[model samples]
Target: MESRNPVIRRYADFQKPGSVLGNNQGRYDGNVITSTPVDETTQTFPGRTPAKPGERVVTMDDVVMKSFAMLALLLVGAFVGWNAPGLAIIAAIAGLVLGLVNTFKKNVSPVLVVAYALLQGVFVGGISYIYQNLVVADGTNIVGNTIMCTMVAFGTMLFLFKSGIIKVDAKFTRMMMVAMVSYLVIAVISIIASFMGVGGGWGFYGVGGIGILLALFGVGLASFSLMLDFQSIRQAISMGLPEKESWRLAFGLTVTLVWLYLEMLRLFAILAGRRE
Candidate 1:
């Protein structure tokens, strides 16, 4: 399986022949007809009707449910963090560490994934509160606008992916990877320059015509990342991954969505700042 998404690539390592769709053997009784014993083959498992064999394989519904559960926990954490923005720095650090741990570990731990989601929610909520305070006073609901835009982008990407309009091929995946690396390099440089007091307000990000462009690029990147995620989930389902892997899928999606939301928030902040 060719996938640019790191989570999918990692999970794909676990797949084996017959691991996805196991072979079915008919039930045999002691009765013999001629030289061979009589065997009963049924479409459903014993005591279960209408449900085909291997029906318990992973499904989109499982991924969606797991994703929703994680989101719900994140919302709860966000509510708590929004009321206490001072903890944003700590939450951000913790979230980053947890994210790295979850990403590198071979076996998925539901507890750790949930913990990471909660920490991310805290970081998001705290930063959102800060951004709202800074930009909302200008009579613009930056946070609300960002949320709406993120949802719109997500829906658009999902539609495009599911409709087969945006195919995930090796070439496309390579291009996306290159673009992401370039963007990350720029971001790192900007952060360093900001710390050194170079380029003032937005550092390299705020240079003439750069700030808005970077923001647009970031939004686009995050949206495309979501598409990669969709492809990963679709592939996982088609390959009949175990249901337990749903947590990994959910974690990956949550991470991308949070990235999208943050980028949207930053874009709006820049615009609001310019307006003021």
Candidate 2:
């Protein structure tokens, strides 16, 4: 299945046919199916010892635990960033660079992923502070509201996806890709406009009804991106990927959740700004 997630799509190990993952099915790009049938009796994968009796494989529990671990690290970083708000821009830039590295790295490094979580947390925390203190109206509780919204969105999407209410097929993937690309272009332009003092320094996202619409669109995009992450993790588990691959899956989920949170934060901030 084609995935728009940069983290999932960049995994070359999953695509390898006769490689460590065994003679599995086709890769993520939907090409190069291995002719050799998988041996049911024997299980072996790279980056770890051979599957022993009662040895663990990649499971939902593993992914969830790793995700929580990363989230903990992120929260710690966020605390530091919240205390020292001046590190916001620097953390954002560093987080972006680390994110790109983690995304493109052939082998998953738990250390690097953990580092990313912390740095990303700092960026997120700094931004949240700015929105709550300087951007939103007094007593708006923008951060609290945004966090609640993000959690709700995540739960809603997971329920919809697992209950078959949402199906991530090729058609759906294509549509999402198009929408994501278009949104990215619009976001870039809006940022530039904001820098140039347009839309009262809020860019296209502050132009009355249009700005509200754009913020809603952003929230929607981030929300739907969760579905993609869910689908990818489900596929990875079904494929019997290595246990270590859980880090990569967790990283992808963290990335999506962070994006969603940021989107919600911005939406709340924009609405609060309008009210003020």
Candidate 3:
């Protein structure tokens, strides 16, 4: 089955591969869902046949390149955030809005996607600086370790998917969806608890053993979420989606990566806090 990810699921093309024309949002004139042959009236981009015109199909390379661009922008934003960690809250709110817009928007806007990356990067960098400078007492290089852990998780998941060790079938998707929802509810409760001065203001996650367990769970969930991202990319390319959709896929992947990194960072911080 296709991923339950809102960003990936919005595309009708993913539901019925090659059913829609290779236009923005995979729709034709007036958002019609027709399967009729591409008549001369259909528009093209630059490399397609005369029948379908020159519209280019989505490719792995397109996703890779767009992902790189998004990451670069994020790094730039992270640099700024590292210098001024105070921007974390403002950037986080702004980034959440942009992320939601980019995820559900009908037409993929590369500009907005990259903007989200930059804003989220600020949040990430801000939190990372706090962890490195204020949290760790032993100079454990927690931030660097978190980055390495995130990368390892990514590579491990990719290997599992490629080696056929883990498959994104309907059952797996359903289970992940359920787990995500449950974890979200718990996270909300934990936040409320934290605000109420529970567990030293860390919520359920700051309650020693329970907090560490929850943090580990979060890291695991985020790691597995990467599989769904990978599956979405594969499906998009196989469905022959429009090249512009690459921006959407890249955005989805970036979102997962950011989530994974954040989870890892939190986990490391918790362990370091315990040590302190």
Candidate 4:
């Protein structure tokens, strides 16, 4: 009933006195209380025993399963797109639109979340193929290297978060948001410059040492974003969000991972370009 919980504060409507959400299992009447306790009695009749009712709150297994489902769909889409890189552009556009829709929508939609994952897979696979062709002429397997680095970074962040080494307090969250906004602005400027034929072929991204610096900054931001996502999942579980919201959590993690992967890819590409 405390508003101090971030997840509860965000979803206050779901925690209304009469609402069936959170741990509010019953209401007090003038002379008695109403409750809906689960019936756990096992019957030995011909009919199968009724299954036990599951907890209403989110769980670790729920989050894990949802994430796995999304990842599987993404891999399938990636395979299709990798073989046909021509669909990358369309997939990228569609992914961007779906990402925005999912982020702004009031309620989570499993279909939209899955669609976004699929589109992102296509975009990622296409880009990976292109990047590999560009820098892996000697068969260096840059894509594999990038994936390894991304997973390592993800695991390191998760460990730090679980160990309480990296707390996601208000100050940390604010700082990361400001940093992300600044990075986005710089990226937009670089993109515009590139379209106008500025800074040779790399635009503002290649100005002096900006490319590598920005790439490093982006990677750091993406890693921090992972921490934020993990904290959010913890908060949701603590506040007893509905199990269905697990899909939303999964989508958030997927988005952060994709961003991290792209940043890693860019960093590796910049380093390879410098070597050449």
Clashes of 2: 0
Clashes of each: 0, 0, 4, 0
**Which one wins by TM-score: 1 or 2?**
2
List model 2 lDDT by residue over 9-119, tens digit each.
533233344443445432222222223445442322334332233334577888999999999999998888888888989998988888888776767889999999999
TM for every model, in the order presented, reads 0.81, 0.84, 0.84, 0.79
RMSD of each: 8.4, 5.9, 6.7, 9.6
lDDT of 4 by residue, 51-101 (tens): 223435457788999999998998898898888888999999999899877
Error of 1 at 103 (Å): 0.8
State candidate 1's TM-score. Answer: 0.81
lDDT of all predictions: 0.72, 0.75, 0.76, 0.71
Among the numbered candidates, top lDDT falls to 3
Instruction: List, residue by residue over 52-100, the lDDT tens digit for candidate 1.
Output: 2444555778899999999998888888789998888999999989888
Ranking by lDDT: 3, 2, 1, 4
Candidate 3 Cα errors over 4 Å, as ranges: 1-5, 8-53
Query: Model 4 Cα RMSD, Å?
Result: 9.6
Tell me which of candidates 3 and 4 scores higher on TM-score. Answer: 3
